[model samples]
Target: MRVCPKSTSSPLDEFLHHYMNGHDATVFIRGSRTPAKGTPAWIGALLSDLMVPVPFPSHSFDDVIKDFSLTDVDFTLPNLFAEPGSPEADPKVSGTIHVVAALPKQLNFDINVTNIRASANVSYQSHKFGELHLKKWHAANSTKVHDDVTGESDLEIYSRIKSAPLTITDSDVFSEVIQEVLFGNGDIILDADATVDVKVTTALDLPGDSLGKSLEPQISELRIIESSSAAITLSAVVNITNPAPYSASIPYINIHLLKNGSVLGNTTLRNVNITRGRNLNIPVSAIWAPEDAGLDARKTGVDLISGYLSSYNTTITAKLHPKSIPACPIIGQSLSNISINATVPRLSAPRDGHSPDNGSKTGRGKGEFIRDATFHLFTSTATFTLVSPLQYDTITLRSVNATAFWNHTEPVGEINYDYSFDAPPGASTTPRLPVDWSVGSVGYNELLGAMGGKLKLDARANITVAIGAYEETLWYVGRGIGATVRL
Candidate 1:
């Protein structure tokens, strides 16, 4: 039957219907779980399936009508008084479905109302069915389902998985209810037994946040891929899980990537929702920009370049606070202070590709410099100047080594230089090195590519630049093709 629940101030006149034998009905309750040692039941009104459109006034979930008895819903058997001299008997059946108890103001969750749903299935049966199969049915079904429990204690209720709807049994079971279901208020108050003390968690997804974070999720891998001095990428696997029996959501999430307690990058996730007892695995990919980290990594990124594994702390800190979808019960609500830390290896690998790992003894030698920017080599060590990638006013190039390559394989002789000169403040360019290299007849055409404005230097060098947490560190400078090669 269609139910029209208008505003309470304008309650409409209503009429109501008849019930038949062997018929079924459903009654739904919206509440919380609690430590009630007594039998549990869904407290509501039992309306007839054949009732006319009923007028239900809008009221709070706790708003329950009292002493309402559906008289026409008496057990009925049509054939009971049907034929003259007929051996068959379709007896009229009648029963009273009354709204007996008023639910407590607060709801509980410990009662596992869903578990109580099981018993509602086997509450009634026909006489023949009760005599022959009722015992077996009750024996089999009762073992698995919940019984119709009636007690005057507090109750807790949960909406569906995503707090979609609070569904109880259907017609034939309990019928029309004398209660209301309003926008849910997350969380139930269960004052039952000691079955509480359950674990509820909240997670936040911040910018640069990845999977495997302690508070937000678990992940398989998180790596930094070095492509060029100006281009880097970080990849991660993020998996969020909802361990509660009901569904939940993370209204806002941001996972920040920290480098030595400094903000490097971040991953932002908004309104993350998960199903009951399920997990959400997300493959996260983001670009790595030095400017995003508040420092000129191209300049200081050189310090992080190394062939040997250097230890730097890669931490995952998240802010997990999700609001309850006011329409659903609150079990797992906003969680805060989600922070995790893990030590990671910092190094720059070939542009082809690489992984995030603390490789065996990862450190660069004297001839190796991080391939962040191109350096011009002077044939003499009289005076040399080097530049960093970070956007800053003054840059200091401590030392560097350069070597030329041919055919992408053959390496020319290598050279080393050390200096302590500072470029004037606000100067965009570094001082040119007085030292020059003589490459007679090996023209500059082969050192450049026709595809783009990129120039190639067929040389590798191990240089030292001030970067990161270190003052001066060794970096491997490999086949860089950005600026002209002045050898």
Candidate 2:
């Protein structure tokens, strides 16, 4: 029988002894203790000088590890009784004691040994079995490897350590580690909210009246009574709408009267007073004489006569007031209305001359001859009324009429005087009333024969009547009716 020695010293005994007795063991241990719990006196002084936070306390080895115990110790020596039946094994009775001890008496210690043995067997079964086993064991037991292993990796070990006789369970260790790792570096965080507003608008396009509307004149009647002249009058009402609410002033009304392509007259509003929403009455009258008629002479005479001849023409026109306001407001403002009425006068011409048998020389006297005449159906009055704000407005009136007349006269020698011839009568022994004188020849017959039957005369007359509020004028003419005759 063989007795195995029981080792009482721990596995860390050699390391602790070397740490205490080595030449630099004091310095090394001091360096190692630098990470121990509580502030180091010298390190604290240095941190105070730098004004930096002091490091927190660290745990000692005794505080970290506890309940260390050996569960079992086993030893085996081969060939203890191998030669019992052989000559070479005459009396070789070598034997070794085998003792199995519980390790640390922890709950997981059994599992740990089983796991280690399994890993070692697995490593040994691989190629270069010895080397692989040695490498695995060395890695598992290495101090650097043990230091690198986190408490998270030793969960089973920690769990078993809690059941050990001298082990302490650290409940806050993980939480403390997490806090230190997360807060090791300073952190910054920001919280914020945002808001915004938007606005929109729209524009509109509208229509307006810039260019004015055109104006058309309204006439009642037109007539040509003579060949070259006619008595014409225009009647029209010019209406204008304000189309606005405010008061608006009309400038003037332009009136143009044309006859046979000729501008008979042009008239403008000389007086106007137009109220808002009201109509104004204006009167208009005009007469045109033939171009051939002597208007100058007829205008000078008191009695003006005009006769209607053939091939005569006439026209009339009236214009509305133009826009007067510098600026026109919206529609429905004040506006104006105007109208005109006309009446044409009668025209006539007397016979040019008296017949030889009926009158004396130089044609019949003014009262002796019958005056031929033509009269217009309409009377001789024209009125124009304008309603607006303008102070001064003008209205024009014109008229034309033509006439022709014939005149006849006897010669001075046609009437012969009957005288008593004393000696001649006695000589003749018979008295006769102008003997050999044609019967009824001594009076107007002789005059007719002396004037070559009867004298002829021609006459023409043109009358123009221009009338206004303040003044009026007329034109006329006369002429012989036929060619002069000689006896």
Candidate 3:
């Protein structure tokens, strides 16, 4: 007989497919946020549930034959010892039997044999025997079995057979599989870049004047003159100009002439004039020699010529006068115009006496009796243009003024005066001297109106003078001059 293989579409096969595809039996099979239930292991759980041991079909049989006729009596059983107590004739027979019978009896016997054979076969059938009995009698006891065959004992087999669904529990089966799929060859890779921003700032400081010291004159010129026979006259002139927009108040102009390291003559301007917007010249002169001279007859002869001549180098020094007036009261007071001049004597020989006749011993000199004489006269002039002496304690604000001009045709009357000066310690009482002054033909209003009618003054005072020779006096000069406008 030919035997056919079990169909591939069996219950076991379906269960295994369900488990491998992730199906779950316990769950309601609804949409869930959890991992899907249609995994291979879940399908295996279904197969296991169906495969549980269940009752199998079984059959039992009993047989009995009726009395037979002559045909049945044809058969005979030969008892090797037909005697009593031989043990072979006992009703409970345990030995093998051999019998001979007639045809009719053989037929009857054959029927009985067939019936008994059928009953015995029924008792030994596979469906009638329990699995435990079959295992004990026919199959050998085995400790090891193929995983697929012994599904109950094999983990893999059990999972597949029961259609066990895949779950993200402590089990590492899914984890191992996922690792192999995602990172089996290598670790997952990624790449990225970063960015940042920044900012900065800075400040600076500059130097400024703290003591209020001003700039001195870049250059200066001085002159001196003297005579020997006549009354010794010394004269000097100092020229100072304001190089700044502000004016300077020179309280005194001190002039000193020195010869052979000694003061030959000295003069001071007690009340000096203030100079504004121009150069200032202060002149000083003094006489030191004899004022008159007499002729000596003993030393004179009939023709006598007597004259004296002496030479000496002269040095002149100047000082800026200080103010006795308090600075706080007249801090912004206007300056007064001033002119300074000095004179010195021009020396000459005295007229000669008439000669006597006969050359008498007491006769006067024939030519003019040369006599030494000295005189003092006006010789030079010094001028200074004056401006107010004020202290600029505050910062200069904005300024606006008309343009200034030189000639009368310029119509320059707008004077934006902004001057300042600081009073030195222990300064002199003499005032400044003004050398020159002139007013514009047009008034300040007329000039300003004609040229937009605006004026401003931004003045400042500073210590511009240098240390003069005389310690008894104070002197100062001016520096830094300019003009600007703002709209």
Q: Among these predicted structures, which one has the highest TM-score?
A: 1
Regions more than 4 Å wrong, model 1: 1-231, 238-254, 259-261, 268-281, 296-308, 311-314, 319-487
Order the candidate numbers by lDDT, best to worst. 1, 2, 3
Residue-by-residue lDDT tens digits, candidate 2, 302-349: 231222121112123322222221122100011112222222211212
Candidate 3 global TM-score = 0.14
lDDT of 3 by residue, 218-255 (tens): 11122224444333344444444432232223333343
List candidate 3 segments past 4 Å from native. Answer: 1-238, 242-253, 274-283, 288-315, 318-487
lDDT of 1 by residue, 99-185 (tens): 222333222212212211111121222201111011111110001112257544432322111111112222222111111001123
The alpha-carbon deviation from the true structure for residue 82 of candidate 2, after best TM-score superposition, in angstroms, is: 99
lDDT of each: 0.31, 0.24, 0.22
Sequence-dependent TM-score of model 1: 0.28
lDDT value for candidate 3? Answer: 0.22
List TM-scores for all candidates, in order. 0.28, 0.17, 0.14
